[model samples]
Target: MTASGDGEPRPFLVAASLSGAADADWARAAAPHVDAAVLGGVALDPVSRAAARDLVARGRSEFLPDDPICWIDRGFAALADAPVRPGVNVRSATLEPVREAAAVCADRDAVCEVNAHCRQPELRAVGCGESLLREPDRLADYVAAAAETGATTSVKVRAEVPGVDLVAVADAVAEAGAEWFHVDAMDSERVVAEVTGDTAQPRADLTVIANNGVRGRRTLAEYAAHGADAVSVGRPTERPAELARVAEAVRAWREGELPAGEPPDRSEASP
Candidate 1:
């Protein structure tokens, strides 16, 4: 259930995210490779977060589930009650929904995150995801509230958002009490990989995680060295066999054989 660990906690190191493509078969496929499974970005509406969160929980076998964004308006539409962990991929720090989402995350012992990486056209029009990283001050406030919830607070940010100051944003997230940060290095065409190079590692205060296109232990190791405390996977868990491969990747990550890339120096981890 641990998302961030010191030296290859699971050998492969996978934090699988369950998106619309998830199901028992998919969950079963990804279960073996992943230590924890997080539900993909939801509508931030409470109902959306709650329903999505429940689905993630059900799909995951034993692993803990953390959902993204608790769509405020979607709360009433939730098929289930609120989950302990709420998700936030909001771009506007001043949005009132952020406050509502924070409160729900606090009340539920759930982990809440700020999704600063989604670039969906509709999301951009609404100013969510990557757009939020531009305003560190407001994002920090939301992170603080989420942390105050007694649940692990984290932020999943999309990189290369132009005016984005990686270090400053990471520093802000840390100062606000966030324990984990999700760095999406994937390119738009590739779903966030290919663009990763550890540019944001230096700014984090707590555990740093790299997502977007982590394939095997080699890639995981390269990321870990670049200052990641952990790494996550998304579409790979589309089915049972793939999920098993995901688990095996975690085991390999712990063993120190990540998919080939720039292997980060195993020096004192940048806290």
Candidate 2:
């Protein structure tokens, strides 16, 4: 399905996490329960080739083909036949490659995410990840360039990065015409709240997807109250049972049927 309509509470977003294609499978299995699936932190530069080579040299990422785009495409295709709206998060050091990658998503009818949330050392070293958090101007330019591709654009940002003005960053992205703002709220719902609030250049079409430690119906409700158009769960959704539980909570929260209480105990969700 296409993304949730404006002002409507989205079902839920399976975060752009690192669970291989298992996350996509979870989305497919949970299709009756959720709204969207963000596929990857797919690297969009030559460094991706090097990263793949390193993984190949280490006998890891074995399921990944040599081409990173193929790896991303395979993940996207998994959800193509499912009802969940698909999105792909891409990390890039420059604009040209982001546009190229966004084009790929446009062709597949998937939103392309500019990933400023990844803090991997290799990615940061090359200015592809959290590095963008330190450069809001460049991040705006990157999102603007990607938006020009005509694919729906989403900017995924890590909100707790020291010295980064997340609200300013989000405002820049929204002003650049990004359709969605995804904030990895880290430890602060306040950050998500501030970013989702009306800014000097607010776009009524902009949707906020809040990502972080969403444990149960209560937590999901909290994010929604804090202004999240949708709430996303990352690592916790890897297990089918956990995914089911979160899906149940999301459904309950959406219907205002969630039992009033503290957040559900998530002891078993830890890896």
Candidate 3:
């Protein structure tokens, strides 16, 4: 839903980057505390699914045996009546599965997030996750493919990748038609402002959501000051206490009750 008079989707606290094990029940549990939830980093196509299987064999948890498309549909179906906005984070070595999953998400009015943040060796080897970061044009192609389905498209990315310029990556995806830029600002919090700030001229308007270490008011306020449209909790997604704290913090920030540190000098904030 609209969070302000600007017609932008409300800045929300989300349960972020949960694994395939996250299902309807998990979404339901997180719904009480989060405005939105991203489920699955599920492998979508056969090649990626094979890679996922290899990962599972090496002790990774994934949505296996169940078809990726079906899994996404089932997850959304279960959340049909829930108050929380639903999103599916998907992984695939090919464009087809990305398009297919985005179609399901489109029909359900949910966000279709492309997983560009996973650093797993198996996933990276198959050209799925962080591998996409190094190939910005390819990543843009994936984002464009997902956007074609009429679903709200998001790309989950992380900072600190050697040789990768996140601002450039953000620009590429936004130009490719992504609506959401989900940043896992690992220790580099100010990068949120770098991407969200108005300095990037001719850049498509993007809803920036900062992820990582978002526990309560302080962290939430910190990202806000950095120009994040929202904040999300990653590792603590299952902890009710943590989730509640973040949810409340988000509410306070949205209502202008929390102090987001000094505004950056707009003149110096540039990509």
Candidate 4:
């Protein structure tokens, strides 16, 4: 899990949320500031790709390209010149499509994230995103298939999906051998902490990345205290000042200067 000899975890990541085709462009500009950039929420298979293309055609999508392969490839090229690690966040329902996308990521030596977080009706209708929450078996199979490709496999989960046992969901993903579990902690940081604590105490092999509403170094430290390996910024990255502040915080934290709260007791980490 350590990317270096010192056994230090990698710096905080910028979770996947760069829209469409222009994700590469955004990553190029943001690369110097973050440790990694996940280039997409890109649709890979023909059905999802068609939906993305249709959105672009209808002027509904600002940064997506009409051609699926071109869209992904262009983003890849953008990351090639980036100053940080490049990753791709892909949305798909079936294992074959994810395998195809994972192959592309493997070719580029980039991370491939399985998106189970998108809430778009169009995506849900196609059995992606929140839809997968109800189908843990399928989700496990999907991540397992992606991992078999030998690309770094990650799964983005929405922490509070209705009626879904997210902890169980995470266990299934980990059991399937996903190296990273990216949690979109929608209004519930405690849930993220619970998941992180559970994964850490027995076997901290899975890298738990806490996402959503992480605004500053304090919040970053807070998540760390909760056992997250890292915290991520999403909408806040749209603000330059906020992004700069977060970057500085990450630097300080990495250098062992950012003040962090005492790690939370795992018993209190219950969701």
Question: What C-alpha lDDT does candidate 2 achieve relative to the native structure?
Answer: 0.71
Report model 2's TM-score to 2 decimal places: 0.84
lDDT of 4 by residue, 117-167 (tens): 888777788888788888999999988888888878888889878899888
Error of 1 at 271 (Å): 36
TM-score, model 3 to reference: 0.91
Deviating ranges (above 4 Å) for candidate 2: 1-11, 19-27, 30-32, 51-64, 258-271
Report lDDT per candidate: 0.52, 0.71, 0.82, 0.72
Residue runs of model 1 more than 4 Å from their true location after superposition:
1-19, 22-29, 45-96, 99-109, 187-205, 256-271
For each candidate, give its TM-score against the true structure.
Answer: 0.64, 0.84, 0.91, 0.85
Worst 10 residues of 4 by lDDT: 262-271
lDDT of 1 at 43: 50
Better of 3 and 4 by TM-score: 3
- Rank by TM-score (best first): 3, 4, 2, 1
Question: Candidate 1 at 239: error in angstroms?
Answer: 3.5
Compare candidates 2 and 3 on TM-score and give the better one.
3
For this target, which candidate reaches the highest TM-score against the unseen true structure?
3
Q: How far is candidate 2 from the true structure (C-alpha RMSD, Å)?
A: 3.4
